[model samples]
Target: MRTTYLTIAGRIRQELTEITQVVERVQQIWQLYTSTQPRGNEFLVDATALNLHSFYAGIERLLEVIADRIDREKPMGSAWHRELLQQMTADIPGVRPAVLSPETRTRLDRYRGFRHVVRNVYSFSLDVEQIVPLVRHLHAVDAQIQRELSQFADWLEQAAGAE
Candidate 1:
């Protein structure tokens, strides 16, 4: 049981590191897009759209790990993606604290919705107006995720020690 807790905590920390890399890349690409005068290039817009999709996907991966490893239950069905995101906001008594705050969940929900649109529609069809705000708020959302997950990792470590 101690080993299990430590292993899960390690995995969470590892995933957080990888997610940070994705966030940095998103910031770089977004900066390039914004630096371009007029910022209307179709290709840059497409790139930003893809990065945003990747960002949300990375976040979902971390949440999935928490659901499967810690929560011992994963959501099922066509709406599982949304379900999984919501799961992180739940405080499962005696199991684990909520991995995300409701505010963070609300911000991330936007990215999740955008991710679905990115998957279903062609890149050129993406709305720059929508993507712009998501990119602008990326840092705030990422900060919340980092803080929450880091605290969760601390909890895992403490639990391991207690065991």
Candidate 2:
């Protein structure tokens, strides 16, 4: 049986909360790094990498739920992650509007790529330069995602009530 729209909306809100937590942790790590800049702590750098990974992972989790429940299908294969992201930008006739804007998808793709690198490499090997940009942009990305997904959730809730 298909999941109820309200149920999916609740899941989306929960994932948004999780993503916010991840963003907060990443901000903390960035602040710590800046305070001790010249010293360059490896642990802080590694923590940043992990939190960044979590941020993208949370987003992917939200998208996966939408794709499965609302869209009625999830992409497959080794490139499914990228495929799923792409899928969210397409407005499906008679189903639902696009879950993400193209700009949001583009911004998210950066985190997705970073998550891939973090997964394959040793935390110690993570470059501070790479982590810096993602950390700086985290807040903006978080805000955009929160706005987009919350709007989507609102739509789901309305659809649920009408059923």
Candidate 3:
């Protein structure tokens, strides 16, 4: 059980690292898109698709970890998983506002829906058009999450010093 927990934790950390890298790359692409003012939209669209794919991949990995833990009959592990999810959600501000931001919330909700489809429906595919907007929203949320993680790290350091 301990090894299983460590394995899950390591996988989660690895996925988080991948998520950060993809988010950084998306930011770079966004910068290039805005700075150069590219003549054609094709490249920009392709970059957006790639960014979305990475974002979804990260989320899928996270859900997989949660599912694995549940399958192993480790409900306590889910508390940490839920905390991470809540932190991810709270880390993004306007991206998924507590109230009055149905569209943003729905975009993320689709991920959960997709997980359900994977687990239950078993015959679902992601269409490009359906995922693009969600990716755009995720880009916005990624910025907020980056900021939140930085702040949280600083808070942790300060608390550790006090103790």
Q: Could you give the C-alpha RMSD of every candidate to the true structure, in order shown?
A: 1.3, 1.4, 9.4
lDDT of 1 by residue, 15-92 (tens): 878878878888888788789888577788888788888888887987888798889999999999989988999999
Give the TM-scores of the predictions, in the order they appear. Answer: 0.93, 0.95, 0.49
- lDDT for model 3, please: 0.49
Order of candidate numbers by lDDT, starting with the best: 2, 1, 3
Off by over 4 Å in 3: 72-107, 110-140, 143-163
- Scored against the true structure, residue 66 in model 3 reaches a CA lDDT of 42
lDDT of each: 0.87, 0.90, 0.49
In candidate 2, what are the lDDT values of residues 91-131, reduced to their tens digit? 99988889999999999999999999999998888888898
Candidate 1 clash pair list: none
Query: What 10-residue stretch in candidate 1 is worst by lDDT?
Result: 39-48
For candidate 2, the per-residue lDDT at 6 reads: 84
Residues 83-142, candidate 3, lDDT per residue (tens digit)? 334433432332222211344334555554444333443222334365445555666665
